[model samples]
Target: MSIVQETPIYRFGDFTLDVTNRELRLGEKRLELNARYFDALALLVREHGRLVAKERFFEEVWADVVVSDSALTQGIKAIRRVLGDDAANPRFIQTVPRHGYRFIAGVSTVARDDTAPLPDGEAAGSPDAASTPATPAAGEAFPSPTRLADRGAAALATALATALAGTLGGAVAGLFGGLLYGFGLAHAPPDPQPGTASILLVLITLSGFLGTMGGFGVGAGIAAAEYAAGGRAAWRIAGAVLGGMLVGGSVKLLGVDAFNLLFGRTPAGITGGMEGAALGLAVGLGAHLGGGFEASPWWRPVAAAAATGAACGVLIVLAGGHLLGGSLDLLARSFAESRLQLDAIGHFFGEVRFGPTTRMVLAAIEGLLFASCVVGALVAARRPRNGLPA
Candidate 1:
């Protein structure tokens, strides 16, 4: 009979241990595991889903050394810790008293390419290694590991580029609104968390995404078409969307207090801070997304805004009434309080009819922001260096 050595490749849950290279990975982080502990893990994975006697372990793992029971126990503990395996209720390595260990866990197997030295040498190169091996289709790996790294680096660079594009685009799209407000294109309170900065932010961000997708779609689609997945454009668009949302909300917080002092009037400390934050996020997102000025509740863009605006209106009416007069007139005064926040721009579009002055102002501001966002997104999308996987 021929002896076939299992090349120390095993996976269970969100983990993989390469015995040959003495490496381990949990999620994405690779660990520098002790040799003995690594050996123990390797043995367990090789005989996964079966009982492995303790004597067999001693013979196979500790053939040269005469180690005490404590040494073995320590090694086992170290292995458990590295694997995040619980002794009480083992998730990876199972314990059996007066016997040995068993790895009764579900594991997906992949044949190691023995032609080359196990590519786990460099810790820094682990992510690139991990990403390449899991391609959706089985065909062939690229030219070299360097090529793979280049692809990953490109992907990350693209992500950052998209973020920057959204920020720049969002600013441009919202120039009109900012000018109208006499704040020179300011977002809500700059001290804020993530999300859209205002209705303009949302519209601009969305429009930018759409425009960039249309402009970049041809190139991205061409790139993606080369691969098995038929959604490169979609992925780029998704990145733009995510990047716009994340960047837009954060970037606008740079001068929120200044904007508040000049054009924003909310000054109630924490409450006002939160309001400013919400407004900033709303505006940032709307500006970056760069969609149309939609106010119809049924429309996806307008509907999303209306839902948020409605909730804000309801909360404001109730909270305002509670804070001011305690009359609980939420139903009656919801609209009056809601039409002023950065988000109210959506609610005022086509969905809710208001006085001429208010509607006209809202329309002009949204139209201006929307135009800028679309232009920015198109500029980004049209650029060839957009983050597309090679």
Candidate 2:
């Protein structure tokens, strides 16, 4: 006489892990998982609340095949993505640093007899009674104050991280722009000027400062919007625009006041709120169209960002607004004794001065670089903690 084994179904949170059918489901939706990933998830759920060592995975999940540790890491990342779980603050799968993983969520199991007949009004092979959606158990439906506090803390942490990423990205863009402008001015036709090195250093430092400020404003705005609106795209774009305008306008106002107080003159037609808003709009739209940073193959979002930035840059120049490059040119012209000569850059484009054509060309380049850098940094910052592709 042969004894039959009962199939065990694991229920945790809104997910169901079926051992016999080899399926994972969130409510009625069946999540997509490869054969190996499914096995890995099952292993974690089976050993719920207990650490499953690296050697155990090799023995149980990959017994037939020889694979490296990265394979397991990638599999875990995939599972996390599908489950909408964060490795940093895991509600389901917890990483034990180099040791292995443990499933921390509260799990309940029910065994079913495959050979048993289905009850009336229930189809065969349908979800078992225990698997059906029901009131969320305990802390899920009505969270304790501690759970709410934890969520708020996590959100704040995520926002800060995003803002920091944007700041770094902007600083990089500024450094690049400063170098381009500095080199062009340094190599002007008359000869390399004595103060060219100092000018270069000043430009780099000033540009980097401006970039950092702009990036912080935009990043903080987007993060706040995401938190408040729960990731609505429209709200996010609006946040970006508002944030850019606030930072740009404030900076321009303070700059004008400072110059007037010291030099008794103010530079007009410099980059300000209008330019910031336009760039922010481009970024928000490009990010939306790119389907977010987690998109596969990676280039889709980056290309979209570059295209939008270029278009916005051209439009800003045409509309009589200015970006960093054009604004600096305006400042130089406002002061006759200023050593910042951008004429060489114009000469490269067949213009004797920093003409309209040159401004447009430079604007486009600046926009492209700024958008690409910011978006790339954002993606890099938001990747899974395990450093795997989402």
Candidate 3:
């Protein structure tokens, strides 16, 4: 029923992807490829040297459900890194921007039984290619899959911690906001629903996720692009900024359906809506970052997550209207009520209003998060393994 086992993976140029082994080999060395990216490779390699249109890539690879365009773009970037393919100055993969990618290489399929042991016997004929499998000099670094997995695991752990921390932190912040507004120390409510704090809690959590996903997604994109471009500052920075914006904005858009489903209707209260937006952002951001540091030393993911966590905190609070009044406050109340906190809790949250201060919150948080991402990305870009500085 599946081509995975029935159809053999073909080898081309110096690259080899053993579908049966679930491996991508370059000469005697197996390249480190994450599962999802590997899937993309398998797809392209199966039809080696052919043009894989962006639309087909989307329909075949990500046809599961509704999603934004960013995921496909990210996936292509990852594949190119592992394959040493460049979208520009095509060595292997040629990008027809606004269309698709074409893999242009000499494809030579080998009998699985004949070349299973050493990256397809004679597949790596170049002298330099042969050296990759040899023992590394004393302190030399090898980009092995095992090493990559270890790094990815560490990042996963940190991201989990940060996400949890953000959740708890947001809940606490929401609780206090409710208390403050309840003492009649805040603004008045426009309708009957859950409270402002309740709504903020949810949105803040979302914001944290988006911050995590966007921050880390960009960071990883920078890493991959660096791997391809040799860490040219201008190139990597361009990649990170563009990639981050695309992924981050896409994550925000994805929340539409979920919001409608969870709220049983378009959300109606103030505070409630803002909180939801924040939560979506935070969670997505966290996941994206976790993926970015997959090839770093085990500690890098934690560092990344921590960096993103800090950013998430700033964005979550600001993106909503807690620090200043904006549309965030206007919509937050509906979300607060959705949680169905006690009628009074809902009432109090609804009363928490936003106004002129909203712009200030946005400016401060935006500036801070932007600065953090820039610094973090630069650090990541400096370390060469893929496109980073050597």
Number of clashes recorded per candidate: 46, 0, 56
| Over 4 Å off, model 2 | 1-16, 19-138, 188-194, 385-390
Task: Compute the lDDT of residue 255 as modeled in candidate 2.
Answer: 88
| Top candidate, metric lDDT | 2
lDDT of 2 by residue, 243-277 (tens): 77788788899888989999999878888898878
lDDT for model 2? 0.73
TM-score of 2: 0.70
Better of 1 and 2 by lDDT: 2
1-390, model 3: which lDDT tens digit per residue?
A: 744323444666667767667898887898887665676676665545567776556444433221223455666777788777777666666777767776555555455556653353445333333332222122113346665565456444433333333334333333433343333222334444446565555555544554445444454454444444432334444545555556545654555456777766543322223433332343234334544322234244334444554455456555543321232344455566434332232334342333234334342443334333433343343233223211
Error of 1 at 156 (Å): 56
Ranked by lDDT from best down, the candidates are 2, 3, 1
State the lDDT at 193 in candidate 1: 22
Q: Each prediction's TM-score against the native? A: 0.28, 0.70, 0.39
Q: TM-score for candidate 3, please give it.
A: 0.39
Candidate 1 vs candidate 3, lDDT winner: 3
Q: What's model 3's lDDT at 171?
A: 37
